[model samples]
Target chain A: MNALLRNKLRAFLTMLGIIIGVASVIAMLGIGQGSKLSIQQQIAGMGLNLVTVVPGSQQRGGVQFGASTMQSLKETDVAAILSDCPAVLAASPEVRGNGQAVFGALNWPTSLYGENESYLQIRERSVTNGRMFTDRELSSAAKVCLMGQTVVKNLFGEGADPVGQVIRFKKIPFLVIGVLDSKGLNTFGQDQDDLILAPYTTVQKRVLAITWVQSIYTSAVDSKSTADAATQIEETVRRQHKIKASDQDDFTIRNQTELLSTFSSVSNILTILLGAIAGISLLVGGIGIMNIMYVSVTERTREIGLRMAIGGKGFDILLQFLTESILLSITGGIIGILLGIAASKIIGSTMGWPIVVLPSSEILSFAVCTVIGVFFGWYPARKAASLDPIDALRYE
Target chain B: MKKLIEIIKLKKDYYVGEVTVHALRGVDMVVNEGEFVAIMGASGSGKSTMLNIIGCLDKPTEGEYILDGISISSLSKNDLSGLRNQKLGFVFQTYNLLPRTNALDNVELPLLYNKTVKTKERIERAKSALESVGLSDRMHHKPNQLSGGQQQRVAIARSLVNDPVVILADEATGNLDTRTSYEIMALFQELNNKGKTIVFVTHEPDIARCATRNIIFKDGVILRESEVKDRINALEMLASIPLEAD
Candidate 1:
């Protein structure tokens, strides 16, 4: 304690490196964990049992038209998969396009989603106000739509009621029947609440002048059966599309399990990257500790001699110096943890980013700091302990 | 009195690169309980080496040293340390007290090594040791805060804390002026009168006059051993000197 106070500035400077190292480790891990958790939550909100079927790439006269252009998915396919695929619990046909939504001299560019009432259930969202399009409206191909929060804000202004009003998509007039509850953003950074939804029949017949939808969205009976439902969907669509056994599939099936694993793997890599970088900085801090401890041993040669002369064993001397170093590092570690938590909290609140500081990381950092102290302090303590008292007491 | 220290034909050699310097050559010495002895010699006469060996800080190249009935040659490093803690005390010319530690803490150092003593008892023993050396008022003062005489007195207290069988002092008054030297020697005389065995190493005849017996070293061997015809009591010597002169 006296030695540390004797060189307070140097001690603090030494601790500074460890402080920064630990703080950065904690903050980086917290931010990474926060984003990972946020991503997982967003995906889960999309429906854990959800699966998607889109048109596969088409080859015409040896020329490939890229995926999503073939438009092989139809409303009949949604009905067929719902009936034939036992694992499928719910299915909705989606005909997607982009257009300018016009309502009383106000216009906003937005993506249009043509889907049925079941689309709301499959997407795990509900109407904030008003009602969904009825089966009567869907059968008659009525011009009725539900606007998203972003579209409502852009076309009608914030807090403006748009239900019971008329809007235009591609110059076709449609009645606005409801507003969708907000879903901020997806993992791909796309705004999920920025599009409007309407009955598939109206969009396919009036806006695009087509009979088939662009994709089919389905939910399985349970999370465990999502992959089975995807395979069953592929078989049913294949039979409907009249593709032979030797021919390539005309549709592509994507399940939530695949997407979730891919995203989690990416997040895992990012967390490890951040942790490894933090570990390197901690190593640098450990080296700094080692350098300072060496200097301290050299400076306190006389003190070592005095203790040894007073019947202190070599082990006692070693323990004393080692304990001092461990105390220094652990103290720095605790302060760094506080600084890290504070920094992450500030950044989280100010920048509107999610932050999660896991208790495991805190414990791990504390443990690593102690190991670093022991590892780096060994040589210096040994040097102090091994000094010959006859010469050390005579050292200038 | 039982023999506290017994050495037969002690020899020590040092190797500086290639040449072996014989620091001690065939020296025989005996120190018994309750005896105050002074060892005097010129530089390179092995006085310091003899003190170090007797203090258990080093081992002789060729000798039979039985310290308080324990054979020095067969003891391990840990056992040597234990012997030093339980049996011998050392006081150096520079009064090698830790600089930033208080006088009481410095005195408590030896007790820290003695596993038999508990923490609370260690403090009380150190406090009384400080009081015995007349430094109770300066117990909380750091070594740097104390004068040369006071620092040496603290070192003496440190040596006495364990109640060792013998005390070894190498030029204990070398750094002090004549009056403070005499004052410190007065403390030593008082400790000796209390039945503490003290072995002192000095080159000055005046300081040698304080010990009851004198042994002079020449090269590595003892050249003469004699009792003081008239010992100078340090307390009486200090009374003759004026306070202002000190």
Candidate 2:
């Protein structure tokens, strides 16, 4: 320890590799974990235990038509799923269209979604201002609708209350009854608050003039029962369509759990890759320790001889050198940990990345450094210990 | 008188690839307690090898060496180190005090190897040892801060700190000037008068004359041995040399 303190600059330089290595390890892992958590939060924001059934691709005379064009999912399928699937809590039939919404002289292009009253609950949305449309409004194919924040901002200007105001979508007049809470942008960079919601019967009768829904959105009783609810909905839908056992289903089910797991696995692989790259740097740091220790032993040959001459033993000399290296590495480790955490915090704020510094990573890096210290310090210390006292004394 | 060092039929062989160089052919000698002896020889005359054997730093190829009644030839490496710590002190030609360390700490080094000496006692002993070598004033000065003679004094103090059976000096004044050499010799004579056993090694006759007895080595054997009939007092010699103010 005293030996290391004697040449403070050299000691610090030798520890540079370790500091950088540990700091990088910590920073990389933090970013990996942070991004992973952010992804999860964004996905969860879409809604929990939510499942969607979209119409599969269809073929007529061996000519293929792409997905969501089959017109196989009807309003009855949503009702059948809710009644037959015990795991389902709520279900809504959906019809989607894109049109320009006009208010007074202002107009904005946006999406319009047609759904029943249960649509808000299944999508985990709420009416922040006015009330949602009642079932009577759905039965009558009422044109009353709810506006999202983006639509409200574009058509009616910011902070303007759109409820009870009239807007025209595709030249058809509709009365706005409520404004949905803001959800910002989702993981795919799509604006969740840029659409308007109205009764599915209105879009089916007046907009597309089709009897079939584009898709069905359903919520499960709990997150754990989502898969079971998906399976039950598939069976119920198949039975309603009276599809044969040998034939392929005309609808496909997608759930949040599958999406969540896929994202989690990808992020986990990314974390490991980053950690492995950082570990290589740590290995380089260990080699640096070994190199310095060897140089130190060679430079202090006379000192070792003098100590031995004055009654110091081989074991004592070994311990002295080993202790110095260990002290160097551990000091570097501590400083690196501090620098890493600071770097993580800075990145988190400056880059807007969610940074989570896991305690396990810090402990893992600390323990690894100590092991590196011992492993790299051993050979040089042993070389010093095994030197011949007479030859060492005579060494220039 | 008690025998502090005993050597009988001591022979040392060194292998230089194909040839075995005989460093010490059969040699027999003994020094009693409180006697100052000088081992004299030219380069490669086996005097350094004898000193190394006496210092317990090396094991002889074939010999019987007993220091203060303990047989050194039968001891293990660890036991030899313990023996060196307990019963031996060494002073070198270059005054090999650790650089950047103060005189007190340099002197305290030998006692550091001795587990029985506590820190408080170690410090006290080191202080007294430095005082005995007349380096009490320079106790806190580093080796680089002191002159060559003062550095030698610190080395002597370190040798005395452990209260060993004998002090073995290999050209202790080899690197010093005439005035400083005599000054160090004078300190050695003073320690001798206080009944400390010392074995001084040198090639200079004048330096050898400071000791009570001398043994000359030639071609790996002792050529002659004699007691100093007219022992020169280093203090008187220092007085004879006219002082030049620095």
Candidate 3:
């Protein structure tokens, strides 16, 4: 240890490159993992337990095909899907548009949504205040509304409770029954706590003045039977729309499992890409170790010769030198781990991502640096050990 | 009498690419315990080659070389190194101290390689060796910090650390001034009187005259060996040796 510390300048220069390289690897991996976790959460919150049914275009030998518009789904279609899809836990039909929302001199243009009470349950969203509409309210098509937390906050001040307050939407007055719990933002940059929810019947008859609904959502009991629920929903919707048996139906069902799998695949690829970039820096660092080790061997050649003269075997010289290199790299690896963790936190805080530093990966980086030191340091040390002592002593 | 080292018809050869150069030609000699012998030679003489072979730092081409009654010719490199570390010590013209290590640690280095000595014992023994050579006050001083005579004393201390059977010096005072050279010579005589055998090299007649006997070499063979009486005292010799004012 004293001998190792004696060559302080050489040790520090050798460890510097390794530290920077490992720190980069850690920071890049940390940030990348943070984003993956965050995105997964947002996707999971969207009732990844649910499946979405949209329209699939009919392909003819893969030519002259355009997207098939799914406009036939409506309140009745949603009801039939709920009843027939036994695997489904709940279901809802929703129509979305944009309109001016007013609450006594505070008016703002917001994304308008008309969805059934079950929409909140199917999507795993809940209200922080008030309650979902009653069964009578669903059948009677009440004019009451449920606003997202953001909409409420925008119309009212931060401290105000929006429940029981009457807000006007495009010249129609409706009392707010609930303010939604904040769901933050989704992967597509859309705020989940921004739109308003009301009865589908009212939205269909009044707001958009359209006859057909936009999309159908059916959630499974849990994660287990999402694909089965989606299949059942597709079958029910196709039959309720009264499409001909010979004609190709337009709607397609996409399960949360498939979407999640796709997301994870992309994220894994992204993680690897970022990791490889970091690994390249480590490779350069390994080369730097090789370079410095060669220089060290040259500088210590005479000393190596002296040790040999005094009873140090070739392998003894090799072991001592190799141990020195490994010690240098491991020390660098430890410092790099600390620096990388700190840098990752700084970046995460700045970008608003929840970065997590994994200890196992840090250990992995340290191990890799150790291997790098030994592997790259072997040749130069071997050369030093093989030098004839006679020539070495006679060397200037 | 116990023979510390013996050589019989030891021949050493060197090959440079396709050409061969014979460095030793069947040389035979024996060195006993506590014998201070000087081997004197000119350029291209085999005295240095003889020194290397006797020192166990090189293998003889074709000869039976026995050290401490064990045949060294057939010993593996590792075995030879072990023998050298346990039984022999060296002092070179350059003083050959590791650049960064201080005096005490340089003395400690051989003990470190042995590993049989406990850590505390190793340090204590090293300090004792330094103290024996009168370098205890300079124990922490690096080689570069010491003058020529002090550096040689540190090297002598390093040589004595393992209590080696023989202390070999190669042109030991070649790099020093006359005053320093005699001072180093006095230290060697002191160590020799303490029961350590000493073998050193020199071309100077005056330096050779200071030893118990001198073996003169010419063209790779010992031409003449002579014993001397009334050996000069180091300090008195330095005082008498003539002229420079600094």
Candidate 4:
């Protein structure tokens, strides 16, 4: 304690590396954990026990157009999936488009998603303001629509009741029959609460000027059967398209299970990568501590000799120096954790990114810092302990 | 008087590359209790080497040293440190007090190495040691805050706190001015008079005259051993010279 206090500036500078290393590690891991959690939450918010089927790309003379351009999936395919796949509980045909919505003097650019009553059930979205489109409205292709929170805010004004009001999209006036509860944003940072939903028949006939649906949204009875539902849907779609054994299917079925697994694996790698990069900084910090400790041992050689001559054992000197180093690192670690949490909160609010300061990461970094202190402090402490008392006393 | 230190054919050598330098040839010495002994020699005469061996800070290359009946050469490193803590005290020419620490804390350091001493007892003992050295008022002052003489007094108090068998001083007055040297020697004479054994190394014959006995070294061996017939009173000598103002 006396030796370290003798040079306060050097001691603080020695602790600086540990501080920066721990802070960076905490901040990076916090951000990574926040992103991972946000992704999982977004996936959960999308739907439960869900699978999506889309038309495969169409090839003409070795030229391939994007998916959903082939028009190989239709409304009959959705019905066939619901009837043929026992694992499938519900399904909906969908046609999608993008257009500007106009109400009074306000205008908002939004996605026009065509879905049915079953789509709302499968999507787990509840109408907050008014009733949903009925079966009568679906068969007649009624031009009644539901608005998300963002559209209600932009076109109708915040907290405005737009139910029963007529809004114009693509020059066609549609009555607002319902409004959905806000879902905020998706994992991709796109606003999930910025779109409008209408019956698929209305979008295909009135908005898109088409007879074919582009995709189908289906749900299994429960989460555990989602994979089985996807397989059954795939086989049904392949049979409906009449593809031979050697030919490629015209549709592709995807399950939330596969998406979740892929996303989690990707995020796991990302978290590890961030941790490794931060760990490098920690390693550098440890090395800095070691270098400073070596210099301190050398500078205090005479002091060591004097202590030894006065009856201090080698173990005493070793413990003293080791305790000093550990104290330095642990102090830096605690301060760094506090700084990291503050920085993470600031970044979260400013950039609108989710920030999670995991307790596990905090404890782990603290433990690692202590270990680094011991590991780096060992060589210098040993050198100080093994110093010859005669030579040390004689050192100038 | 009981003998406190026994030395037999003490020898020390230094090797620089292929050449071996004999710092101390065959020599023997003993120190009895309540004695003020000065070992005098010019540089390269091995008085420092002899002092180091007697202080248990170094081992004789080819001899046996017994301190308070424990053979120094036969003892392990830890045992040597234990013996030093239990039975030996050291004062250096540099006034080697830990810098930036208060005088009381500096004095308490040697006692900290003694396991038998309790914490509360260590503080009380250190305070009395400083008081004995007439630095009770300067106990809280750091080494840099005190003058050269006061710092040496603190070092002396530190050596005495353990109540060792002997106090080994190496040129303890070498860094002081003339009056301060006389003052420090006066304190030493007082300590010796109180039944404390003292062995100090000095090159100055004037400093040796203050001791009751003198052993002069020349070329790695003792050349002469004699008693001081007229040991000057350090306090009377200081009174003859005018004291300087701060």
- Best TM-score among the predictions, by candidate number: 1
Where model 1 places Cα greater than 4 Å from the true spot, the runs are A5-7, A34-49, A54-114, A124-129, A133-143, A149-160, A167-174, A181-195, A199-215, A219-251, A256-277, A351-354
Which candidate number would show the highest lDDT if scored against the true structure? 2
Q: Order the candidates by lDDT, highest first — what do you get?
A: 2, 1, 4, 3
Give fnat of each prediction, in order: 0.60, 0.58, 0.58, 0.62
Model 1, range B88-184, lDDT digits (tens) per residue? 8889999988878899988999999999999999999999999999988999999889999999999999999999999999999999999999999
Q: What's model 4's TM-score? A: 0.79
Q: For all the predictions, what are the DockQ values?
A: 0.62, 0.59, 0.55, 0.56
Between prediction 1 and prediction 4, the one with superior DockQ is 1
In the range A213-306, model 2's lDDT, one tens digit per residue, is 9999999998789999989999999999999999999989999997888988999999999999998998899899999999999998999998
| Candidate numbers sorted by TM-score from highest down | 1, 2, 3, 4
- Per-residue error for B94 in candidate 4, Å, reads 0.3
Query: Model 3 reaches what TM-score against the true structure?
Result: 0.81
User: How close to the true structure is residue A10 of candidate 2, measured as C-alpha lDDT?
Assistant: 91
Decide which is better by DockQ, 1 or 3: 1
For candidate 3, the TM-score of chain A alone relative to the native chain A: 0.73
Docking class of 1: medium
Interface RMSD (Å) of model 4? 0.9
Candidate number with the higher TM-score (2 or 4): 2
Error of 2 at A111 (Å): 5.2
lDDT per residue (tens digit) for residues B51-80 in model 4: 888988788899888888888898888888
Per-model TM-score versus the true fold = 0.85, 0.84, 0.81, 0.79
- Pitting candidate 2 against candidate 4, the one with the higher lDDT is 2
Evaluation by DockQ, superior candidate among 2 and 3: 2
Instruction: Give me the displacement of residue B201 in model 2, in angstroms.
Output: 0.9
